[model samples]
Target: MTEHVLYGGKGGVGKTTMAAATGLASAKRGERTLVVSTDPAHSLSDSFELALDGEPSAVRENLFAVEIDPESRADRYQSIVSAIASDLRAVGISLSEDEVERLFGSGIPAGGDEAAALDVLAEYVDSGDWGRIVFDTAPTGHTLRLLELPDVLDAALETTDSVRGQLHRMATSTRSMLMGPAAYFGREGGEDELAELKARMERAREVLRDPERTAFRAVLIPERMAIAETERLVERLHEVEMPVETLVVNKVLEDVDEGCSRCRTRRDQHRKRLAEIHETFPAFEIVTVPDETGEVHGVESLERIAERLEL
Candidate 1:
């Protein structure tokens, strides 16, 4: 059984750290794990202290990582559209050059970084190649948009298909007039490709919505802006019935440099904000990662953070 864990929060928060930590923890438990960064501004490669590409690379025992390049994935997406056009051409009436350009223009019709990332994600989820997949998602807004992508894509595809159906009728009639009754025109593989694409989308939707297989972990710091963003994110997730069961309160000032007045003030502020978090999201299981002396990166630091999570 494949289990997916996604960490999402406001930008500049510790989502990448938490995601890396969680991936380490899951791998420590002997699960084959892959930590993938879906953020267009990816930091997973830095976190792992290993150069990574769009393809997964081994980071440690049982652990792998990938930082998706949205542009590269968008190119792959465009290729799929082009392939579909080729498949259409195989049977009979080929689309006009303008039609081909329109279909493949700008990649997905309702496309953006999030859509590109989700297309990569959908591929991974459909593959079922890893036991555990941990996602370091984009900021709150982009992550939410990615989660909502399937519905948007479904609607867009439906509209496109309807238009194509009408065009198909028109094109077939034209071919009949030109080639007579025994014309060699058919939909050929176009419908099959469309069905395959739809199936892939539906499969991605199932994997994301399955609570038993998918979990969302929100990472935030004890700051006003982070708290506000997280609250809004939770509300949006509730609206969509996407499950977010945990809150990781990262960068909590614990055992800070006592002599520093700034540290002291921030620590005090953290405590109060933490109280608000407890009050605001009472249902969430709260976990804490205390502020480290230096930046947390690389496998060792991520492992330490994972230990702090006490998972």
Candidate 2:
């Protein structure tokens, strides 16, 4: 079975770094790993020092990376919706071109990006290609929405299918009465398409909630606001039954010079916040990553972070 690891938290909390490092670590352990950036604002390529696209590309031996473009995914999702509308029209449902345009003219619906990301994620999970897959998710709010979307979308799809069936039956009855005899235009293709999407969403939800196969790691800085946000995130995760077991406290001031009072004071504040983090999430295994000398980019830096991650 393939294992999944997702790193998520507030924006600029080094989630991409943690995810990249974890991928490197997994690959070093001889597992074929793919690091995926599901964030709309992708920084995985910058972190890896290589250009990436929707398709997975080789990063190093046993390691591959990809960045899911939200815009492209959203466009694809819109196309799928348009296909369903076309199918309805083919089945004798009265949908004017103007009405269809009105319904889908808007670029992307609310949560469309997340829904598309979920679809892409399900495809990757079903592929059974990588030994392990690590995800660098979006910020806390967007990541939470992504995790919650499967259920919301499933319900919406169910409702849509039911309504479509009812409308089809009504259309068939009316046409038969008017024309004396009318052939049934069954929409098996559209139904199958919807069914497949529902199944994919359900599978993704299962993978997310399964602890043995999936791990949700929250990454944050040693700050009060970040800690509070993480606490809320963990609570929501627990509510959704996708509990987080690991917390990464990144960019902690590790070694303050004795002579520098300013550095020492900042380190002291970090310690206080660290203690609070432990108190708040006592069950979580917290990993502290010290502030590096410079920007954390490139494979070499990621390797160092991987060591700190102890993956």
Candidate 3:
């Protein structure tokens, strides 16, 4: 079974940084790890300072990363819908090209890439090659919708039960005419499409909810916004019954003992919150990663992150 580690929180709270560090930790343990970014504004590549926009690249011996292509995903989705439209026409249900495209595009964001990327993700997990996978999801709202998509879709399917059954029968018969009935239902069709999507979402959620299989590591700085976001995230995940596992305090002031005004004030703020984080949430464990001397970029800098995490 593959493990999924999700890093999530409000935007710009070091969620991606924590995700990259987690992957590095797993890789150093000699486990094969694949880290993916589901954010439309992907910065996993930028954090590592490596090129990964369209395909997976071997960042290290056991580490791989990919930033999927949204345009390609949308194009492939269009093709699937076009074929579906043609099949509907054969059954005397005339569907316009624009209408078909609109149907596929409906409910999804303006960009089809996330859905496309999700399509690929379902396949990768099925492949069962990697030991671990880390997903750097988009900010809170978008990520929640993605998590809830399957339930929404299943409800829709139930509401359109008769139409779906007819569509499936029509699709099966059309495929039966050529290359036997096997290929058509197996490839792309109404019932199969619905089942595949439902299964995929549930699988991701299973891993997401499993504490051992996946962990949602929320990152927070000492500032007001980051701390406030962390509190909200904690409550939200609890409502979903998938409470966060770890809290990472990134960019802490180094050398609290040093006699410096800026460091002293920042250190004081962090110390206060650290106490609150521990006392308020006794079940949760917190990890503090101090602000390093310089920027954290590239493998060496990221390695320091693993060091902080003690992996």
Q: Whose lDDT is greatest here?
A: 2
**lDDT by residue (tens digit), candidate 1, 286-306:** 998888777788888888898
CA-lDDT, candidates in order? 0.80, 0.85, 0.71
- What global local distance difference test value does model 1 have? 0.80
- State candidate 1's TM-score: 0.88
lDDT (Cα) of model 3: 0.71
- Residue 147, model 2: Cα distance from true site in angstroms: 0.7
- Model 2 TM-score relative to the real fold: 0.92
lDDT of 2 at 95: 77
Candidate 3, after superposition: displacement of residue 222 in Å? 1.4
List ranges where model 1 is wrong by over 4 Å.
79-104, 184-189, 257-261
Q: How many backbone clashes does candidate 1 have?
A: 0
Worst 10 residues of 1 by lDDT: 182-191
Best model per TM-score: 2
Q: Which stretches of candidate 2 lie over 4 Å from their true place?
A: 74-80, 83-98, 105-108, 178-182, 185-188
TM-score attained by model 3 = 0.82
